[model samples]
Target: MDTTRSARIILVPGFWLGAWAWDEVAAILREQGRDVTALTLPGLEPEHPARGEVSLEDHVGAIEAAIGAGEGPVLLVAHSGAAIPATVALDRNIDRIPRTVWVDTAPVVDGSAMDASFEGDEMPLDALWEEELGQGSMRDLTDEQLAQFRRRAVPEPAGAVRDRPSLTDDRRLDVPATIVCTAYSADDYRSYAEQGASFLAGVLEHRALTMIDLPTGHWPMWSKPAELAAIIADEADAAAR
Candidate 1:
């Protein structure tokens, strides 16, 4: 396999996160002589003024633009809530993205959001979101991490989380994909199964879906960046073959 030609990988962060989340992971990949770019979705950073009105379309547009300017094929590495927008962007620009890697994230089928699967149930996401916002940086993290998280973590746009994506009828993508699972507890794995089984089942058809259990919380890129980057780089090299 020609590893040189497979260096392009784009990292997409989840809701309330910016590209800064991938700083350590990007550094690791770069140390290995790989090309990586971490993107900040609109409304997630202080520079983006449309935090209140940004929609799912805007999120996808930001990723699409990044892929458009890149050279050759890209392996999109999406984390947490980014899986939906990342996949939607690939579906829209199928020619640019050659592979997708979902990490500790919720997978969406067709154009559904992560919340769609819990339509009839009482999910804890709403409460978690409210609590996290109300408590601010005190919600989750040590004192050191809180200061940093506060600088980058911003309020998610209402429409982006609520709106359903527009998907193409084509079920198959031009490139293969893989799912890397990172959960802190057994309950987290069960949650992924319950909310994202439908989407995961579909991904199994056109690609080789692999799951790696990271004992860290949802953000392995921050907790174990070197390991995460190695897994991603290895999978990307294999996918190119």
Candidate 2:
């Protein structure tokens, strides 16, 4: 155990998921000799009493607390919907985070809400929610995977997803940031690649941001844990260099 080589990597799962979602990835990272912490946001666990009322601020606070608990700078990995909270947290506590990795995630630009990111014709959140409810427990995952996921999946806090993110113009941080987009289907891959390119174009224009593409689905940590862990470790190493 080389303590000096240990890097604190905090995993922030997407909506309707918990720390359990990152079990495999965390295990792999640990095996590779990196320190990893998988976070379960306030409303993510079935046992959490505030499951319905947990706000974006609450989730951000949780991430901040986790980062503060660590001894040094952390590499915050935000997946899907968690990207907003993670970005806001880094903005709020820029001193604590060393880097950020957005995994098949969404980034909310200035003055944009989650709702605003979607085009006028698509209803992603609503449609996805309805489909998930109809399918019961897991929508896209296989039976075995869904069983594993359901053991941890709880209803996400309504406010956490609804609230808008607030970021300051003090744009760049001391650490580097990377966005890894994973798309299973060709259409999804193309869509996210375009989104990632557009985002990297905007406010991120002047910042030192890295972007990578993976040939996996949105939940790569579950479907491709080894690959995901390797990519994350590579990013962490790059930041160190």
Candidate 3:
């Protein structure tokens, strides 16, 4: 038995998603005897009265709290827009998290907003789909998966996406990051980084950046759960070691 597999895994969902989005992947990780905590961020929960008031910092606080609550080593598995807050939280709690597994998303640099063009106090799932579809982010999802997502999706707080993140600590750049490319190839991601894509700026500056190509859609937790789980497990084990 490998004792290093003891690292706790924290899964953070992207916009319009909750902890439930990681169900399949979490179940598989659990079967492998890994501890997992899937987080439903501040405004992503249903029927929240202050949904519009939740800011990017609120999401960062939530992630920081989750990481602080864990013992030993911790690994973060962040998907899509969740990467914005996750990266800020990572900077605040760098020593606790040994590694981060970014799912089809990279860290958003300091002063960068997750969605600067987003209007209103909240953004609905349909609107997000319209934007993402143009990038082919929904390519591989099945109709059933799409329906299920639409049914469970919640409106993302505009502040969480529109507000910029602040990072005071530069040590976070030293932390290892594993980018699981789902909607695009690893080479494509590198090219974007090389081309100085603003969204990938932080990742480009990361000291230990590794990319894994797992071609699918943006929601690999539904489109390729097993493969995603395996990759996460591998990273968790590595982090534990």
Q: Cα deviation in Å at residue 44, candidate 2? A: 0.9
Candidate 2 wrongly placed segments (more than 4 Å): 1-3, 116-141, 173-175, 184-206
lDDT (Cα atoms) of all candidates against the true structure: 0.68, 0.69, 0.88
lDDT, residue 75, candidate 1:
84
lDDT of 3 by residue, 94-114 (tens): 879889999999977888896
Instruction: Check candidate 3 and list the clashing pairs.
Output: none
lDDT of 2 by residue, 11-103 (tens): 999887878889999998888778789998887766776554667788889999898886866788998778778878888777666677888
User: RMSD in angstroms, all models?
Assistant: 5.2, 5.1, 1.5
Query: After superposing candidate 1, which stretches have Cα over 4 Å from the reference?
Result: 1-3, 115-143, 169-174, 184-207
lDDT of 3 at 211: 93
TM-score for all models, in order of appearance: 0.79, 0.79, 0.95
Model 3 regions lying over 4 Å from their true place: none
Tell me the TM-score of model 1. 0.79
Q: What are the per-residue Cα lDDT tens digits for candidate 1 across 108-171?
A: 6676665543332122234465565564413334567655765557666665666677778354
Model 3 TM-score relative to the real fold: 0.95
Which window of 10 residues has the lowest lDDT sum in candidate 1? 117-126
